[model samples]
Target: MKKRRRDLIQLSILVVLGAAVILSLVLPQLPGRGRELQPLELSVIFREADTALWSNTRLGMEQAAGDLGAELRFLTLTRTGDGAEQTELLRREADGGAGALVVVPADPENLKLQLSETVGSCPVVSIESPLEGAGLVVAPDNEALGRELAEAVLEDWRGGMVLLLDTAVGSTGVAARLDGAEAVLTAAGVPVFRQTAAPGRLAAGLRVLSSVQKAEAIMAFDPYATEQTIRAVEAGGLGQLVYGVGVSTYVVGALERGSAAAVAAWSDYAAGYLAAEGAIRLARGEAYTAEELPFTVVRGEDIYEADNQKLLFPVTS
Candidate 1:
């Protein structure tokens, strides 16, 4: 009887030890143990490498990602026309477990459908270009931007013709900008002529733009077009004044050199941050939606102002 009792006690001890070992091994993964949360996976796609025009937006995304404990995957398509590349990247990221997506679409309209079919369930945020299928889009008010620039031209009331230039092969947003600017210019009786420039064809654009009389004011819809206009001016000055819609490091030089009168700078950082945050919220089943980032018409002197200084110098990291 004594031997049997000792054996029974030993068995109980062994069972207790085994249970404790199992619990120790498993408890950390259970809900009650530590309750730690993991970071989410987020991704972003750009038409090309990050630039001064996109630095603010990228920084904004980084800030939001850090705050939200998300990992950001940034991809750039270097080719001149790579809309298809963007769609493929979208598929690859989604398949590889990206919970949310943010993109500056190479072809905004075509990417819209591809995004829906490939990652339709994932919450998507469109950066500068608005996507029809995205859950939320963060973009500057381009119409307001165009209107503001035109108003500035009206204030100066330069008698020379106003020239509008855009390189969007198929962009709806450019149309909105043109409409807004034209509305103001036509109302004020500013003569306007528009031309589309092929990529790396500034000379051809110049030849196309040539007229008997020089233009009074020129509006370039995007930064590239603006740079071409600047290059054209450097090669052979065309208009009396120039205005552009986006910000680039070169913009500072343009303003200093008096090549560009002013540029309607969009809150690119806000666009990046808000789009990322909003997409995350949507992915997490929150009630997040589309938002419009603000814009500012900045000139050479305006760069000295506190707000304009930040816009002039943005932190990307």
Candidate 2:
């Protein structure tokens, strides 16, 4: 009887081994199991010529590309707000066999028009600006970001004129931010004046406007504008409390030095990482969903906090 029991145990072990081999073969064939995705070629186009503003974003993209086995080509316009140039670049990248296209649209309306005409088979993902019917969009809620900035100003604002500076005049994202800030300030019975400047002339414009308009506080709607506004304020000795949106190094430094009061910032690092990953998944025919990253209002005191530090300064390595 003992010999019979030993033989039965050996038979059971053999049966288990056979089942494992069958599973190993069949599992790979099943959906969502051990599938090797093809390496993808991704193209990213930014709306502006200054790639410096997108440094953290680029790092995030590079990290995702390395992790996901994808090749990335980064492109930017020769001038800010060059819709025609952006369209041409999009067409060239797609026709040159890019598996996916990611864009910070210089002109969202123009890009939406080009999407069907230019991109034949490749999927398109938009970052920082939303394109309706585009596969996915990864960005912060611009309106909310604006409201946050405005609220930061309202915290200590007793009363007086507040200037809403619009450096990127045509950007829907920037416009949304301006609108949000306006809504909040207007609802609070604050007098707000909307201001606009030509690209590359915001500093000069601010210098001229501040000399005449007499705003008690200045709120810039984008990163470049915010940086320029802060510099203009300090250089002119305008004494207007500066508040804006963005988290660039200069903006952070200004906040630390108390030249700028506060900034509404989101993680551009997360934005870049999500855009690349979303494009790859769309290229691979996998499921992808639009992502809206959150924002934070960083003041002088909040800059060094652990959570805010990560939001403001992402570790590239």
Candidate 3:
């Protein structure tokens, strides 16, 4: 009996020692128990600062930084959205120890050479606009977005005058949208009449709207065109369905009130999320490839749905 007790005590002592050794090996790596993650720094550079449009993007980058256990530094140029300014900003960011970069080239074509020289070996992602020689990109296909809008409108209207209100100085993506819209409408045997005006030129848009004598459905490229045409139609007693490429409180209200049909644009929040994720991956010595984001269309009927609400009003999209 004494021998049995001695053996049992020895076994108990061994078990305790084994547990102590295991804890010593595992406890040092537990983050919650005091160890902290290595915080990586990432940068998101935009062409310009538009809070209404880019608020969601900021939220998205914040979330991505959290998810990736990294930090985000957002940078933007003035309202001009100039390529030269963006190039200068890129140089500064690269010199600032930015582990990775995500940029929206104001003028991709013009800044191609500058980008090549500045980006160097660091991982760079492009959003909003494609940069020449940029391997990784994430943006909505403007042509596809335009085609989606045109297809949606074609279901109701046919073989009539379709008015397209666009900006006089449009970006490349905007031109792609216009091209897609015209191609689709033309193929469907509908005639498209386009009128151009500059941004912040409400009177110019309204003047163009007044000149559109007859239009079955009216589409606009920029927010100014969209909002101005909708306002003109309502005030002047012009009965025409309006659609466009942006969404705001006014646009959503218009959609609900039957003054607007639908609007198409890339979810800016999603853009930020994807861009941050890509930056994190690249910073971690991972690879990336360029791809186009999907287009989103919000109409009056399902605008209130949970998923749509998340996409449309996520940080005021």
Pick by lDDT: which candidate is best?
2
Per-residue lDDT of model 3, residues 1-317, tens digit only: 99999999999999999999999999887775542445777877776545454676777878888888988888876753566777788778877778788887767776677667776766678776566765577778878888888887897785679987665242566667777888999999898888775444443345454546678788876544576667777776677888887766777788899888888856777778888888888777777654687767778896898877876787532
Cα error, residue 22 of model 1, in Å, equals 2.6
Q: Give TM per candidate.
A: 0.82, 0.85, 0.73
Q: What does candidate 1's lDDT look like per residue over 212-247, in tens digits?
A: 145777777766567667767656755457788777
In model 3, how many backbone clashes occur?
A: 1
Which window of 10 residues has the lowest lDDT sum in candidate 3?
Answer: 198-207
Which parts of model 1 have CA positions greater than 4 angstroms off? 1-38, 49-52, 199-214, 235-240, 315-317
Q: Which 10 residues in a row give candidate 1 its minimum summed lDDT?
A: 203-212
> Which candidate model has the greater lDDT, 2 or 3?
2
> Judged by TM-score relative to the true structure, which candidate is superior, 1 or 2?
2
Residue lDDT tens for model 2, 1-317? 99999999999999999999999899788885643544688999988788788898888888889988899999988887788899899989988999999998878888887887878669999887778647998888889888888888889799898988776655788889999999999999999888777556666656776433578888888777788788888887778899888778888888888999998888888888898988988898899996588888999899999999999879877
Displacement of the residue 108 alpha carbon in candidate 1, Å: 2.5
Residue 135, candidate 2: Cα error in Å is 0.6
